[model samples]
Target: MSWLDQVFPGTSSKRTMIDRSQALPGRTTPVAVPASHVVLGHPLRGEDPESSAGIGRFPGYQAVVLAGGCFWGVEEIFWQVPGVYTTAVGYAGGYTPNPSYEEVCTARTGHTESTLVVFDPGVVDLEGILRVFWESHDPTQEMRQGNDVGTQYRSAVFTVTDADADLVRQSARRFAQVVADAGLGPITTEIAPLAEAGGERSDGKCRDGRFYYAEDYHQQYLAKNPNGYRCHASTGLKYPA
Candidate 1:
C-alpha cells in the first residue's frame, strides 16, 4: 500500500476528497483550462455538428453544463447517452476564473467540478438530460457527493440558455417528489444560468464565461484508465417517464 493508504488507517480519507469553505477567496489569475479532449480528439470548445435535412437530424444543438460528484463518472455517463454529442469536464459555478483542479478542491473557488454536455435535441430532450443528472447522484447533499466533500463536488445544473433554467427547475420538482417518496431529503441541487455560475462579486469573470477545459490528463479520465476510481453515487430513481 502507498503512504496515503497507510496514513488513513483503513479509512477512505486517503481516498476521500476534501476542501475548505466556499466563502474563501480564490486566486486572481485563471489556471488556464486547456483545449483538446482526451477521447474526442478535438478542441473542447468546438462547434456542434450540423444536422442534415432528415428525421434523424437535429439542427443547432444546445449545450448544458452539469456538476455531480467527481465528474469523472458523471462525464462518462453523459458521453454514453444515445443523444449526447460530446462531454468535457471542467470547473464552474465558482468565483475563480480558469481555476485549477487543486484550487477547486480547496473549496475556495466556489466552483463545482462540472461537465459540458452537447446533445442533439431531436434525439434526447432537456428532460432526458435532466433525467441522467438526477439519477446519477444524490441531490439531497449540499456541497458534497458520496465520500467526496467540497463545493467542487456540489450537485448543480448550469444551463446555457434562459429557457433551460425553467426546464431544469421543473425537472427538479418532478424528481424531488420521487426523492421525498423514497424518504430522501429535499433536493438541494443548484439551478442557474451557465453565466451565473463561477461568478464572484470580488472578481469580474462569471456567467459561464467560456468553459475552461480541464487539464488534458483529466479529460475522459475514466475512458483512458478504465480501472480508475469512479465516485458517483446515483440515486437510482428514474424521472417520471
Candidate 2:
C-alpha cells in the first residue's frame, strides 16, 4: 500500500483520473434537487436554460461553476457573498451523467464536487468572486485538498462562456503569481469552458460539462448540519488589489 492508502485508507487509487470508458455507468435520471436553499430561500433550480435575459431568472444575473475541494463548504461561502442569488452543490468536469455521490466518491465518475453560483453581475464583479475562490483554498494541490485526497477533490473552474473562460485564465495568471510569492507551487486548476448545450458522448461520459445537482442531503449541507465537516486549505496569500 502507498503512503496515501496508509493515511486515507481507500484513496490511493482515487488520486488518479479514471478514463470515461472505465467510469461508472450512471443512471439517466438525475438525483432529486431541493426546492429552495435553506439559508437563502431561493429556488434551487428554476432558472430558464433558454432565457436570453441572463444566466439566471433575472436580467444581468450571471452564473459560474466552481469546484474547490468539498462542495459543502464552497457552497456555504458563495451563499453568503453579497450578490449571489443561490448556491447548489453538484458534480461536474467529468463524464458521468447524473452520477450519485457514492459513485463520484469512487473517482471513476470523473466528476469533481462542484458548486453552481448565480449572482447579480452589477453588485459583485467577477474578479471579486474569483478572488474569493483563489484565497479560500490552495489551488496548487492537485487531486487533493488538505486531508481530502482524491480526484473528486481537485480544484477547477467551469465557465458558461468563452469570455468568462478568458477572464478566469487572466485571474488565474494573477493569482498564480500571488501564490508563488507566498512560496507555493504552480496551480493545477482545470479552467475550461463548460459544454452547456448537448453534453453527451457515445462513450457515455458527460464531457458536455453540465452541472449535475447533488442529492438533497448535500444542498446547504453546512447550514443543515451546522457542525458538519468543512475543510479548505489556503495559501494565506491575498489576491492582487
Candidate 3:
C-alpha cells in the first residue's frame, strides 16, 4: 500500500467534532522539528538571546497559537509582521498529545492545523496581531476554511492567559460584528485559553491545550517551497479602526 493510504487509513473528513473518547491515542514523544526557522533564522523552540524585543509575560516574549485554514500561509503571514519573533506551524486546540499531519487530516485527532506566533508586544500589540488574523480568513465557515473541508482547518485563537483570553474574546466579538455588518455569516472562530481550558467540546476534561510542532518539512513550507499551495480565504474586509 502507498504511504498516503497507510497514513490516512481510509479516513474521511467528517466535519464534526469527535468525542474525547474517540480521539486518537497519539504517541508520547513529540514530532522532531528543525532547531531554527527557515525564513527568520531564529530558534523555533525558545527565546532568542539576540532578540532585543521586550521580555513579555511568557519568558522573553508573548505568544499565541492560531488556527485559520492551512498553517503554511498563516505562518508566512505572521513572520513578515514587524514584531513577530518567529513562527511555526503546528497542531493545537485538540485532544491529541502529539499528532501527525496525516492524523489531523483524518479528523480523528480533533486538532486544528495551527501556527505558533511569538511576537514582541512592544512592537505590535495583540490587537494588531488579531487584526491581521481577522482580515486573513472567513472565520464563519465553522469546520472548514474555503476548499479545505475538515476540523483541522477551523479558525481559532489559543491564548495563554485569562487576560489574553478576554482580549481575544473581545476581538472576536468586534470582528463578528464587523463581518456581520459586511453581510457575512456569524463568526465561528473558536477563542479560549491554550493552556488552561480548551475550546468548544473541550468539556474541561481534555488535556491542557498544547501546541504540537509539525514535522520539519511542514515548517516554513512556503519559504522552502516558494511555489507551494497558499490558501487563505480572506474576506477582503479590514478590521474596524
Candidate 4:
C-alpha cells in the first residue's frame, strides 16, 4: 500500500497526495468552523456565491504563505519588502489544529514553520513576491534547509489561487533551469494549494481554519534577537537581468 493508503485508507484514493515530508503520519485533528465558512481548496457542496467572491476585491492587497527554513528570517525578509502590509510568523501546512509551538517543533503536529505575508499588489506583484521568496532561501534542500533538518524547515510555497499555483509551477521550472545552468542540483521545494481548515471560504470575512498564533516573543524573533540564527541563503536568482 502507498503511504497515503497507510494513513488515510479509503480517502487516499480520492484525495491528491502532495510531496509533503513534513506531514506526520495520521489524520489531522478536525477543526470546527461555521457552515457558511469555505475552505480554500475544497469546493463548496452547495451554491454559496458569497463565500468565493473576494478574489480580486482588494485591488491593492493580497495574501500569500511561504515556508522557508526558520520563519524568523522569512518574516524579516518580507517585513523589509516595500509593499508588504503585514507579516506574521506561524505554523502552516500541518496536520494538527491550533498546534502549539513546542508540539510543532517536535514534528508530531505535522506543521511547517511558515510566514504569512500580506502585501499590496499595486506595489509588489505576485511574481515579485515569488522572486523574494525564491531568493530568500535555498529550495534545493529536501526536508531541510542549511543546518535546520526536519520537515518543519523544508521549503514550500502555499498558493491561494489557480493562477498563483500555475505561476509557482512555471517559476519552479524556470528556477530549475537557472540552477542547472549554474551546475546546481534539483529543486525540491514543495508547491501546493493552501489547504483550508474545515473548508472555510475566502470571502474576506472568513476566519482561518485553524490559526494558532505563535508565542508572543516569536512575533519577530530576528528583530528581537539580532544575533539569532538564520538558515536562508541566496540562490542567485535575478529576473530580467
For candidate 3, write residues 57-174 as lDDT tens digits: 3366789888999999999999999999888898877787778899988788878999988999889999999999989888888777777777889999988777998999999888
Put down candidate 1 lDDT per residue, 101-193, tens digits, no spaces: 776665656667889887888999988988888988999876677777656787888787678899999999999999999998799898877
Question: Candidate 3: where is the Cα deviation over 4 Å?
Answer: 1-13, 47-58, 197-208
CA deviation > 4 Å runs, candidate 1: 1-36, 40-43, 47-59, 198-210
List the candidate 4 regions with Cα displacement exceeding 4 Å: 1-60, 196-212, 237-241
Best-to-worst order by TM-score is 2, 3, 1, 4
Writing each residue's lDDT as its tens digit, candidate 4 over 72-177 gives 8898888888877666677666556566677666665546788766678889987888888887788876666666666677787776666787888898887788
Q: lDDT by residue for model 2 over 127-206, one digit each (tens)?
A: 88999999999899889989999999999998888899899999999999978887887999988777742255454544
Q: What is the C-alpha RMSD of each candidate to the true structure, in Å?
A: 7.5, 3.3, 6.0, 10.7
Instruction: State in Å the error of residue 170, model 1.
Output: 0.3
Root mean square deviation (Cα) for candidate 2 = 3.3
Candidate 4 CA-lDDT value: 0.63
Model 3: weakest 10-residue lDDT segment is 49-58
lDDT agreement with native, every candidate: 0.71, 0.84, 0.80, 0.63
**Index of the highest-lDDT prediction:** 2
Return whichever of 2 and 4 wins on TM-score.
2
